[model samples]
Target: MTVPTPQAPRHVRAVAVQPHWSARDFTTPDAFRRWMRAQLEMARPHLRPGGVNLVVLTELNGLPLVLRGGGWALRLRTFERVALALFLARLPRALPVLLRERVSPIRALQLADIDANTELYLRTCRELARESGVYLCCGSAPMPRYARQGTVLRRAPGVLTNQTVLLDPQGNLIGVTDKVHLTPDEEAGGVDLTPGDLNELRVFPTPAGDLGVAISLDAFRADVIGSLAAQGCTVLLQPDANGAPWTSQEGLPPDPARVRDQPVAWLESSWQVTAQRQIPYAVNPMVVGNLLDLTFDGQSAITGPAEQAPSLRSYVLTDPRPGFLALAPWVTEGTPDELRQAGLDRAAHSGHPLENEYREDTLHADLTLPPATRPAPPRTPHEDALDALLRGEARAPRPGTWRAALPALPLLALPLLALALLRRRP
Candidate 1:
């Protein structure tokens, strides 16, 4: 048998997709097929670059399978339990039968979920890689099951983990990386998820430079972006799900604006962060809801350190950057100091109380507020009222008193005035 040569290094282009919600709502296999077909249609154009890889994200249990002529490939099956199910129920029993019948490798078999049989699935994937001549990457949630065994609670601390594996052309395991940052809630729950050490950033070590893959949506964080850039990560693969839009204009919902400053602060600090959404709905949609949106909403772009910024090279099909290139954009033409001064000037012109007046002759410096001195205690309402009374000003009666005494007080006043008038006449 002629040995297969390694695939040539090609430009990597990735698109992040959030499959329509209808795909997950249905239980029937036919509905699933139709949805999968539609998704493939949406994704096909983006996959044209020769070395392009698609990062498809979905929930732990919601992976989709793509059928070839003779066999099938499981797409984005991240959950090991799902892998186990496929192996026991389908592959192990069917493969031998297909070989005996002399069926084409692509046409004679079907792909299904195999939960609890990770090793078998890995072996099968390696075999497919050797035969099919296409690289396959399955993105999944980094659940705690892979870290240790037995009865893991989803809510329990130390249950969430992030990991990804790459299969070579001959189906050999190339590299794997555990995710660095855990979701805040996951951290609060005491999940053992911590940032991956710099040494572990090796998921994409092909001839194409380090192609570090970020499972779920960890690529959105500023620290993660900076860490990946620092480690020379050229491409970042992000698998994400469709989520509710971050901003709600109607008063009916919580406003993303209230917490927008936190991410803005993060982006301002770290410049290189590129993310592509992947398939499988498991962690994608839920994580998107938790963190702010990863897609740039065209509102504002971040300007920061050039070395740490995303590649200034635009995404062109013809001139793509090598292996997992940084997604953050650098401000090569503009300096950060200039940007800072411009921001300060904008703030001053926008009526900021602390901003110094602009002077034509000289640069204006930021004005500092004087240290506040404590004022004497304020007088009580009662004390103020007594003081007013002592000063000969008429004290305002309590609210109800005017109504209660109106008739009696007016009658007495009129009679007393009449007596005074008669005395004066005499």
Candidate 2:
């Protein structure tokens, strides 16, 4: 017995967005809903005519707003930090409230609040899809939902894996893909995410064609990308939560070539996945806005098939600003079967473009990736501060200043005081 070959739509119009989202956006659920609505409105004219509009978003992006909606515990835990002593002191009080967040009447009530807001946004997306007459991937934002005993999986004690939701042209759910690879850095920040079942990696049928969703760092793995290609995923939906500065080289005299290569435009032009014999088209959206001193770089991008990667005209590096980058919108062509087959063939050999480990994997595994040898960019002040927080250390600033002398005063006097005490005793 043989399976039928899957097909791709003749045309696809994918849109990647990197809008302004901040700590302020997490103030209220309604505020966030409205912001998403506004973004859809902004992308209105750019959407393809009767084609797939691939929309991506940051991973677990709506979480802060949801947590804040819970009133005190999460809000205090997230935004307002007390001293180490004070934080530990409140654990008795904070602990119960946190546990309660996942249980009982409180869970139901909060879900009602969050779910209602989410539904409102989905309704808006559906209406927009109906009105605009285009397929919408609708950015993937996670909800800390409660699932009752059901067909999906055995009943759990609330809290499930992060799921990426997509809205069809008529405002209906086309697919729900749970994120497979959760970022370790995110887990360190107190959000304990569960990985999805590997079976969920299968492509979902869409009006545009076979759609596969990979969240954030999942795309960093060559094995993961290979798996999707093997499963006949014609188009890739990569929603990212990258906070790395696109233009981190702030102080040092910069290289013109490096600056030119750092934009969404550069990725769109160079990252033709079809040339690598993977998917014919891909849309990747990045999260923007600063939260708790962490400033996100907005470099959302789009890519398609090319004969070969084009060497572009190099321009002088001035202040290269980052914002919503767009490629000349066009329709996607070609069936994904050949593209996917070619990818599988390359993975079988080690001909993958990324030089990434070309192999199949389970939903979870330790992937050995090559070390990054890219040029290091200078850290911004905010970046340096964030780096300190991550390292869990503090240092005295400006060694030559008087402020620095204050900490060293006791050390300087220690030997002198010891000698004086010894002489007096003699």
Candidate 3:
């Protein structure tokens, strides 16, 4: 008798999971590895050709304990000071420990933490990128010294302490962008550091596409979103560690108000202008909790050029089924002229809506362009002086006097001191 052969399972499209939990919650490294393996098991069936598995590792605060073992407990009180000293003293040793512990099956990972841990966190991420074929990205900011009530002292200051970085499979730095805006207290000098410029924006080139990520809580601003959209940023990841009031209110926490409002604004603004909508992810809580309890509020979607109508897609994990959010495969293309036109349109529209008087003026301004041709003129002495200034040459009132003062001051000081000493002898 002949037996029938079983057919192999059909392959499905791949989806990325943004699990908002920490890797260190697992007691042992092996347990963490098992958790990662299990995640892969759940996602494997859906893995498809050219698909990406992106996981945002939330709640990485316990990383120090996970990598250093129970030994970290002894220095818990002075963890910041000790961790800094240890990291500076033995970065060579610490880097390997971090890579071995944090495990995930995702093609890319984003880790968020407080500012003090930025150095050690990035170093470990760099090492992990080398060993694993996954890309790693980090986001951080200086801790706030004062809470809403009063003065609070955050230990780490403006020390390159808070940052988000991406690491390629080879562990080389692919992209790095600093957090632009800070929380109210952070900007108030509660942490002893100056806030970074909110205007600094960057887009990273990835196999997936040109991923434009903004490192600011206020990235939800309409102007910022419009600007990034104009610049061709499709994926906007907002990794926020703002817990307590933002996540919960009166002991009952639903989705955050800001989180919900921002993504909606991004969708509406991008859709109206260019049709290139953004996929916005809000990685919140920044700690370990019941996956079932945690809710991803914003829409997980993809948008195309203005010519294509917007399609709204949302992925909500109501239960622990362990599925992924599948995105339509992306292909790189030339910079869309529509994006530039949309940007210009937005800028022209952003002026005071109440000011009807400037309507004609604004229209005229938008339509005008500078002349393409100009005549070259001879350079005058004043022009030469201005040119020298532009080139970064010193423009002192008396060039020689200022230049000679440095060496002359020391010689003058010694004689003055000697004369004073001689006079004091009486």
Candidate 4:
């Protein structure tokens, strides 16, 4: 009798696709499809046959589709021109919707193109998922509520949302999740978006595990991830697009005594989740490159449960942390000093053709999902300390005495002091 060899159990093999956005890729529906297909193709090689393969993309990856058919204006290389072109082209139909919905012309223009954009976005995702035979998170895009009428998708009367969709290998929609937390920029100005309800957060079950999609900023919120984990979500997908320098400060950072880099603060997100929620697996894909005046950059990473050997592709990090399985290579090639000299921290765009910002890449990791009935990992000391600190702060009494005003006396007297000095000088 011949001895039979036993095969290892199938597990989740995921890829965080780091795509560099370019206006040219979204010039037309065909172009957009090609770009999306290319991204999936890059990740396809890493997937194992007959296993769960998941592809994660960043937030706003599809928002550029709003500029479809503005190929003539792309050469101008300004979002203003593209928006003007699209606005003029859709004015006839958009004007009526703007009047009816009482929305800003900026938003109305996006709405006018919603149906086509949504249809193309859905079709491209479906085709890619089916062709690649992998589960796909189609990233987040600004979209209005829509109804499917047979083969067509029709826009309904609703506010636009930053929404993401997950699809199965068979090209079926598995789940949809909208960003519940909006950045200040997203909530203010013309982009005023509707936030998703926390109560209705969706968790989709898969062979890998129960998966939760938390788009960008939503992933940082404890309540959001906690709700998903409570509902048996074992894996978290955080699609991000930080529209600023990755090395810049995240709005003054968390410490007033010292400075903190934005990307380092961002690392706290996925790492914090695995430590807190006991959701052992998480993927964060970031969209890089520039579009008009806006620039997006970040290092894409796949985080696992515990410490592992870091990949060579990790952003020559200043502070290396555990739990990161893999990280996409940095967009610019240089040492910290060389990069700083190259204006890596500045807003100026480097026109170098060979820069990694113009290229698309993928970071892959093979993760074994915990069993369905697995218990939550024990809390770490760091988490316990944090919890205790939060409790102590909550119980601390707020100062109501005149001593509270002492700290602000100098600030309050600054204007008066300046006025007296100016008067005396005159």
The numbered model that scores best in lDDT is: 4
Cand. 4 Cα-lDDT: 0.69
Which digits, one per residue and each the tens of the lDDT, describe model 3 over residues 44-142?
Answer: 443333433232232223233222333343333232333333333332333222233231101001111222233334444444444444444433333
lDDT string for model 4 (58-130, tens) is 8987788877887787765566555655665665555555556666556666776675676678778888989
For model 1, the superposed segments whose C-alpha errors exceed 4 Å read: 1-10, 22-41, 49-137, 144-160, 168-172, 185-199, 207-209, 220-223, 242-244, 248-258, 261-271, 274-426
Candidate 2 local lDDT, 35-89, one digit each (tens): 6666666567666555455555446565454444333333333232311222234
Candidate 4's displacement at residue 367, Å, is 1.2
Q: Rank the candidates by TM-score, best first.
A: 4, 2, 3, 1
Which residue pairs show backbone clashes in model 2? 126-171
lDDT of 4 at 279: 79
The model with the greater lDDT, 1 or 4, is: 4
State, as a TM-score between 0 and 1, how close model 4 is to the true structure.
Answer: 0.78
Task: Give me the candidate number with maximum TM-score.
Answer: 4
Whole-model lDDT per candidate = 0.32, 0.46, 0.32, 0.69
User: How many clashing residue pairs, candidate 4?
Assistant: 0
Q: Estimate each model's TM-score.
A: 0.37, 0.56, 0.40, 0.78
Greater-TM-score candidate between 1 and 2: 2
Off by over 4 Å in 4: 1-10, 148-154, 253-259, 308-317, 332-359, 372-426
